[model samples]
Target chain A: MGWFKRIKDGIQTTTKDKKETPEGLWHKCPTCKQMLTTEEHAENLWVCDKCEKHHRIGSVEYFHILFDNGRFKELETSLKSGDPLKFKDTKTYVVRLKQAKDKSKLTDAIRVGHGKMNDQDIIICCMDFNFIGGSMGSVVGEKISRAIDASLKKKIPLMIISKSGGARMMEAAFSLMQMAKTSAKLSLLAKAKIPYISLLTDPTTGGVTASFAMLGDVNLAEPGALIGFAGPRIVKETIGVDLPEGFQTSEFVLEHGFLDKIVKRKDLKNTISNLIKLFAN
Target chain B: MATLIEIEKPLQKLLDQLDKAEHIQNESDVDVSKTIKDLKKKLREKRKEIFENLTAWERVMVSRHPDRPYTLAYINAITGGDFIELHGDRTVKDDKAMVGGLGSIDGQSVMFIGQQKGINTKMRQYRNFGMANPEGYRKALRLMKLAEKFNIPVISLIDTPGAFPGVEAEERGQGEAIARNLMEMAQLSVPIICIIIGEGASGGALGIGIGDKVLMLENSWYSVISPENCSAILWRTWEYKEQAAESLKLTGEDMLKNKLIDGIIKEPIGGAHNDPEETFRTVKEEILKQLKKLKAIEPDKLIEKRIKKFCAMGVTK
Candidate 1:
């Protein structure tokens, strides 16, 4: 059987059984409601071919897409969150961290890797939203700050893919401190004139929007990314007003000159490499 | 927001008695003028006492008082009506929430940038309640850069609960805008001073907050997070915002103790709202004094020392 047909059959069987199987062989696009075979979905770089909707992706997929031949040395970004507050609302923070680690197979939301893109050395940190909404805590902060150091030491270009809800509520003030700490570290890269490209993805909000994610030398975003300091619901509650159509979408921000460009998933690598070459002098 | 002259529950009964006594005096048939004079004196003294002993949460409420003087009031006072309001981010339309301009203080040209909370409901709507969009930060940065080009000091008056958390603000890169300001302000050749005139909550305040010396009003609160929001995450109810306020150590005294701010500016006995003119004069004098010391240093040393100063923050004293 062809890979597409086989995967589609697996999805059909899972639905027929209705047992909630671990294997998800076919997926539906949230935008256009188009069912796509999982094989075709991965091959399309996780974007919906029918609707061209950029699907939310994790750091690992991004590494494959951006790194030349999907090859790179992943940075050791495993810093403990330290559960500074011993905070618990519904569940203990440590328990939540363990659950997140189990589900995402990531030590934390961010993954840093040093690799070649179009024969140019670069450091890239991608944030994964699947891990507790990619809420930045001490681990996320320290890892990304170290990534900045890595770029400065190696004298390579840097890129950060942002996907977060905001500061991790569990971490409280510790998470908020990251805003200042990360911004302070980014200035070292700025003083060195090292090029840093910021690529924002779905649901970038809160403290992340106010820090290193926004400090890129060249700021870029994936098409239709929800990038803002506050989400729409919280804003409506705070301001008691309905937002204009397309208020915080990539196109909306680009029109207002907040971003340099909105690059397609397919074009992200080439676009970044071209910019890197421009700054190669 | 405040309902002008609205007192907290603790002082509400006293104010009500004062009001009744005044009304009796105004009724010519009553002839209670002596009682009215005593009530007025009691009200004044009571206001001073209550303000002096306010809880941190009450202070938070006062900081956002609708009738309180905002950044524009202080800037206009300092400039002595010579404030020429500038506009636009060049790339985006001007943000009404963050206002900046070329203004003169005692004949010395300086760039004054600040968050503006409008006075009335209509004006508040127009200013987005002093919460800035990303464009606002960019506008502030553009004006500061202009000031830098002309060799002028930059002063930022911070008074935002936080940056606008609207989806549009995030979409437009609010974090990037604020982060850029922090980085650029550190390297700015000209002296920079920041005054937290009201609420200095989280990254919103920090967006334009980096400076050689950071100051706060006696009642102003500066924290990593706002009390209500902190309460929501911690205790699951904003009812605990008072507790959160106390725990966060956000008052002016906490800021001074933590070394987060250079000093605290004294407000009127009943807060800036009771006497804005006196508050403005004091702020103006404080600015002029800080400017005198700041201007004496060379540009490079000013930048270097400014960076070092921020780097030393958060150290345990």
Candidate 2:
């Protein structure tokens, strides 16, 4: 309810009645409830405008936000999931899966489509956390794997926007196995000689951290994403100790030699396109 | 009273055994060599225990044993036909640590990419003790590309002590190379089966560890970081490696329990190298079985399933 309230508040505060500007003039932090100025938000990568909290952007939205208008063509979009295990937890797993499917409004947690960030052909897989907490389930895994295959086939670079709460729990062992499955797939992508860039958003944890999210060609994180495997609560519980200030956040990860760079959301497209152009195939 | 007696049956048996162990019998004053022999027999019986009973440090040792068999050894054992070793990344010199070649596994055309460690000093230097440099990872990437082009199922054997940490490796970009492998491997349309024959240590093992079916030798281990490294971090001393190992959960048993690996491949008694032929046969059978299962899935489903598998790792209770 609080999250929905925040979204509603953001929608209510926006004064543009004619049309939403391309890439917009100003925005609010997706996490903390704060108003942001256009210039300040631009400087911070359209992040929070005030609180510097990173927000989820869809593959198409990411393309638009990063590149010029209507530049991306979706690739490997048809991969879907049929319940393999017939798994059940709490209620029938399939029932919950359907609910997540309806709520997320996406076939899977990830969307893999190719587009130009800046006149450069790059395959993008954007993990939407709003979709079942952006858990990597079978369909999400397959889509990402297919995206990599497409990138290799086309001989282009890949840019993944990661915002996950790790692997999907309802899927049981079937879900946990994705860590190895995706990692293996990524290994093949490497063999094909393609560069994979990871753009870590908020709360990339669990199996996602164990596999591809951590294994980026150029590991970049948003300003405030928590990028560790064991969340702060779990880690504190496990070790019987309090975490340092900002333990799993992107800034902490960057400081600990885990991340490559911390790119503001505004500069994401320019930075990625420049990198792609620089490493032109 | 009868119910109480029935409940105490198991406890009485345990108490009797403990009493026998604690008490001095008439044989205690007998021949010293005989006494020594009895104690040795007891110790031998203790060593025979498996899986759950093992201490964390013992698991680490088991994971790192030279005679535990490695990726190269398994590949050699599994492939009955002729093999041709591939070399070079085309962008750099060949890395001996990682061996990839054209091979046939039970008549199925395949590309083999695996980390090879050494049992001795000369071999360790030659194989970098299974610690791959950037070039090693590069070679793997090249091989995978070739395999994808040919639509060959890539059989990757993972056994490494993490990526090479030398200055030269860093200069060439060790992290970047590992990351590159992770990125590229995800997109490969062709099937991959990664088997951890020995130590699956961190990023080094992960460079070639993505797979449709990821299997581990029963005694092998997989983790994000080694016990020593974890110990250095948590306790500030390598001596706390045992403690670190327990905390890190790096054992094959733990991995299988945690669902980090698909299943465990049974090994020969006294480890793989003790009975290399038997170890080879078991590995081959298991691999072939897994390959057959994976081959049935459609390419789209395969990729999707693989992605889901990764996405869902460590998400369970």
Clash counts for all predictions: 10, 32
lDDT of 1 by residue, A1-281 (tens): 66554433335555467776357889899999998889899999999999899999998899999999999998965466676445565577789989999988888888899999988999999999999899887778777777988899989999999999888776655566567667777887888999999998997877887787777888899999887767777777865888878877888778877789999999999999999998885
- Residue A73 miss distance in model 1 (angstroms): 3.9
Show model 2 residue runs off by greater than 4 Å: A1-281, B1-52
- Model 2 gets an lDDT of 0.70
What DockQ values do the models have?
Answer: 0.25, 0.09
Instruction: Provide the RMSD of all predictions against the true structure, rounded to 1 decimal.
Output: 6.1, 12.9
Q: Give TM-scores of chain A for all candidates.
A: 0.91, 0.82
lDDT of each: 0.83, 0.70
**Model 1 RMSD vs true structure:** 6.1
lDDT (Cα, 0-100) at A219 in candidate 1: 85
Worst 10 residues of 2 chain B by lDDT: B1-10
Question: What lDDT tens digits, residue by residue, belong to model 1 across residues B175-282?
Answer: 678888878887888999999999998888888988888899998988778889878867788888887787667888866775657999999878898789999999
